[model samples]
Target: MKTEEHKMKKERWEKDMMLEHRRIEMEEQRLQWEQEQEIMFCDVTTMDDDQRAYVLAKRAKIAKAMSASVGETASGESGV
Candidate 1:
């Protein structure tokens, strides 16, 4: 026994929930990919400075894309 106005409001709420559900689903998928990638790469913290430097130099582009801001601290940590 819903009024016409109430029916329209219900429909709008349903549509909004549907769109929000889709956005959350997409974000979950992206996070899964990131976790998988992290597992595939070697752990740099355990490597010596020289080895870390070599790996860092070769992977500079990947770091850049990940928004890494290189500086003095990085130099100390990455020296090979």
Candidate 2:
């Protein structure tokens, strides 16, 4: 029936919209992460050797903590 067909089409359209929204959100998050990494790289470039090593160590510690919280290992494997 035409009414049933219309309902199916509407549901498909809504699901597609939701998927697109999620994709956009993921892309934004990726871009923000890349920007933060670039900023950190720039800071390291301006540092003396000891300062750079300290900053890198701090960054690594923070990364490990974040990965652990998300159930991932520091190497990015799932902590299964």
Candidate 3:
């Protein structure tokens, strides 16, 4: 029936809209992550190769540790 087809079309349009919204949200998150990455590491000019590697590795480790603790501290603080 035409009415059934109309409802189906409307449902599909809504589903497509939600998908578009999620895509935009994910792009925003990706951009935010890139900005945070830039902020997390300081630029070291004229450092030797080994020293630069060590500094970068240390920063990455700290970032990883913070990321690992997310569910505990962040959620608890928000609820209080």
Candidate 4:
């Protein structure tokens, strides 16, 4: 029947639209992650010695805090 065929076409179109939106969202997220990676690993060769030292210190502080948080979580889970 023509009505049944029309309904099927509409459903397919909606499904295709959702897939396209999801692909666009995923690509945007990928680009955002790449930008963050670049910021974290930017070229130190273009920075002065003081700037490099500051960046390294900042990163080390973040690392220490992250490790401490992990240890806290593990101990809390074990009822310690």
lDDT of 1: 0.72
lDDT for each residue of candidate 2 in 24-55, tens digit (9 for 90 to 100): 99999799778657645666776899988877
Model 1: CA > 4 A from native: 43-80
Clashing residue pairs in candidate 2 are none
Candidate number with the higher lDDT (1 or 3): 3
lDDT of 4 by residue, 1-80 (tens): 99999999999999999999999999997996675566567788889999999777766765676678688887885312
Full ranking by TM-score: 3, 4, 2, 1
Report the C-alpha displacement of residue 78, candidate 2, in angstroms: 18
Worst 10 residues of 4 by lDDT: 71-80
Estimate every model's Cα lDDT from 0 to 1.
0.72, 0.78, 0.76, 0.78
lDDT of 1 by residue, 4-80 (tens): 88999999999999999999988997996676466448688998999888767656655654444355446565421
The residue pairs in collision within model 3 are none
Which consecutive 10 residues in model 3 have the weakest lDDT in total? Answer: 71-80
C-alpha lDDT (0 to 100) for residue 39 of candidate 3:
47
Cand. 4 Cα-lDDT: 0.78
**What TM-score number comes out for model 4?**
0.55
Per-residue lDDT of model 3, residues 1-80, tens digit only: 99999999999999999999999999997996776576466685767898788777777875776676675577665311
